[model samples]
Target: MNSPIIQLEHINKQFKNKLAVSNLSLEIQPGSIVAILGPNGAGKTTTMKMLLGMSKPTSGKISVLGQSPNHQQVRQQIGVMLQDVSVIDGLTVREVIRMVHSYYRNPLPIDEIELLTGLSEIDLKRRAEKLSGGQKRSLNFALAMAGNPKLLFLDEPTVGMDSETRIHFWKQVRQLTQTGKTVLFTTHYLQEADEAADRIILFSEGRIIADGTPESLKSGLTKRILSFSAQHGMIPGESASPSDTQPDHNNANSPHIHIKAQIAMLPNVDQVEYRNGRWSLYTTDTDTLIRDVIQRQLPVRDIRIETGQLDDAYAELLATMKEEQ
Candidate 1:
């Protein structure tokens, strides 16, 4: 693997009354897209600013492209899009792109920027102040690309983008990663990170609480939801009781209630909700549940098993962290 493009070791940042970041250490690999995720006041922005050299750490060392983050040589190789937009007002989009491009020895062509960023011809001519929120975000992304830097930092880069535009932006980002550019982005959109990032680092209360691929994180905190609709005579309070006059399947409390009870007893089964002839089972051991269902001859149809999602994992992860604190 290539050497890490950015590294922070035992970094700490303190304000007058609070510690914004605490002993944080991370290494970002080249050509990889890493998403920094956390709830509000989780030190996410502080960590990004420290890595970009916009804010100095109270202690410890930091490096970008194998040099001090603030080093002029390293600065030239990095592009940054901050959460707070700072482009001069009244400047045409093309002019702003050109101005930032001039600072770099090798910059992407203006036309290429427009194409890659999904900026229309009219957008290029419009003044920065006149652009809508989403348009301004697109321009911000275009400016970041102008430097043709090896590494890029985007904090909430898709803040105001519509769904279609956000999807386009991810496609462009993937193209950049293909050409060996490293990107470190922070987003409140968990699904965006889940979809776009190769790795996710979750921060909580000024520290990294979790780090892994989205699938792995989801597996850790979430369970598959197995659902099926069936008409079994299972009532809430009683076990299956088949009457002599009624068939077992027709006994309102017999088959369905029995199956529900059996499933609830299975190891690793979290919860079960049954209503209106529909059953929703939450479990980590889905295979066992399936096997038991088959072996027990539970009457079920329209079976649907949904894999765990990153959103559920994120919520559970934070909830667990809060408990630990």
Candidate 2:
């Protein structure tokens, strides 16, 4: 395997009396997309700044491309699109691109940068400072690519983009990875990371809390809910319905009084609840439970599935952290 393109050892950062990042350490494998996620003031921004050579770590070693992050050669091989996109005083977008191109020995072509960033001819002619937020971000994106860097660092890249543009941006990033470019981005959009990154690193309180693929972090920490409206049905190798279940005194006339218990007996079902004429079954093994539901030929309709999302996992992790503290 190729050695990591970036590495950090016992890294920490402090501001005045506040400890921004605490004992953070991780490595980014070459050609992989990684997302750094956390709430505000979680040290995510600070860490990225250090990696970009804009800030010095209070203590510890950081290496990018086998050399110090601040090394001139290493700086030339990386591109950055910061959260606050900057514009040159009076340069047009096209001129801004050209100026950055002059700094790199081998730069990406202007037309290709335009194609990758959705910059129009009119946009290229406009003064950089006069562009809208999204437009400025696109210009920033184009400038970052001008150097044709092997590694990219983007913070809140899609903040001001419309849905179509946001979608396009991620698609472009994915394609860039196919050519062996590595990307590291930080975003509050958990779903974006869930959909885009090959791996995810979660940070909180300036410390590493979790690091794994989206699937690995989600499994065993969250649940999936399967729901459908079902008529009384039979379970193979078991009675069609429990005959001995005592009728509840208050709900003796209600059909749902016994239905809950009957559904609870389904394979791999952990909890069953019914509301609005639909039954929701909670289970970790939705696949097994779904198969059982189908094979039994139960009279069911309006089948719906709700898998635990990254948002759910993030919340669960945060709550756990609070309880531990």
Candidate 3:
């Protein structure tokens, strides 16, 4: 395995009375894309800033490309697209790319940068201020890649991009990784991480909640939801029906039954609605729950079982973390 291209050892950062990032340690390998995912104020931006040397760590150490982040040589091998736009508005698209290229020793060819970024459609002569949000984002990407840096940091790179442009941007990112450049980025969009990252680090409350390949993180959350519909009416909860309300027609009436069972203790199962002649249940252990439901609940009319989706796992993980905190 290759040595880590970036390393953060027990990194901590504080502001006044608040600890933005707390004892966060992470590693990024060469040619890999690692995405940091979190909600607002989770310290993702602060972590990235620390790695870039824009903000100093209150404690701990950070190294990028085997050297301290503050090292001039290490700085040359990195490119950044901050959440706050940093381009000069007066420069044209081509001019901005050229200016960034001028700062690097062996930048990518100007025509290649234009082609790779799909900037051919934009008027290269048009000033950055005149471009649409998506256009500007594409230009930002071009500038970041212009230097051909070995490591790149993109903070919320697709914030205002349209679906088509975002798709194109991801394609370009994949191509970059193929060329041996490492990418470390932070995104609020979990789907973006799912699509682009080879590995995902989930951050919550100034800590790493989870870290693994997208599939591994998903598989680690292996949960199944079992659902079914029944002809007979079923009570939603575990509580028994009131004895006083028992009607003589209870034995004869065939009302729809709905039961919601949560398997593996996942907190996704709300009250199951079984009106209109249908029954449904939600659970994390599909096969086991299905078996249990079949044996215990009995007489299910139709059954369906499926693994928990990425969104479901993510929600459950965060909810569990929040509850613990």
lDDT of each: 0.83, 0.84, 0.76
C-alpha positional error of residue 112 in candidate 1 after TM-score superposition, expressed in Å: 1.1
Per-residue CA lDDT of model 1 for 1-325, tens digit only, reads 6888989999888999898889999888999999999889999999888888888999989989999888998888888888886667888888888787788888898788777657788878888788878878888888888878899999999998899999988999999999999999999999999999999999988999889998888878557888887544443444443342223456555565466666666666787877555678888777888887777666677888877678888888778877887
Instruction: Quote each prediction's TM-score.
Output: 0.84, 0.81, 0.80
User: lDDT of candidate 1 vs native?
Assistant: 0.83
lDDT (Cα, tens digit) per residue for candidate 2, span 198-269: 899888999978899998888747578899875443333333354434334376543455466556668878
Clashing pairs in 1: 233-252, 233-253, 234-252, 240-254
Question: Per-residue CA lDDT of candidate 3, range 1-325, in tens?
Answer: 8899999999888899999899999888899999998888989989888888888999998988888888999888888887765558788888877887888888889988887657655578788788877777778888887878999999999988899989999998998899999999999788789889999998887889889988878776655555555432344432333342222324433122122222223244443534344444554556565556555645566676545456666787998876887
| Better candidate number, 1 or 2, judged by lDDT | 2
TM-score of 2: 0.81
- What is the number of backbone collisions in each predicted candidate, taken in the order shown? 4, 0, 4
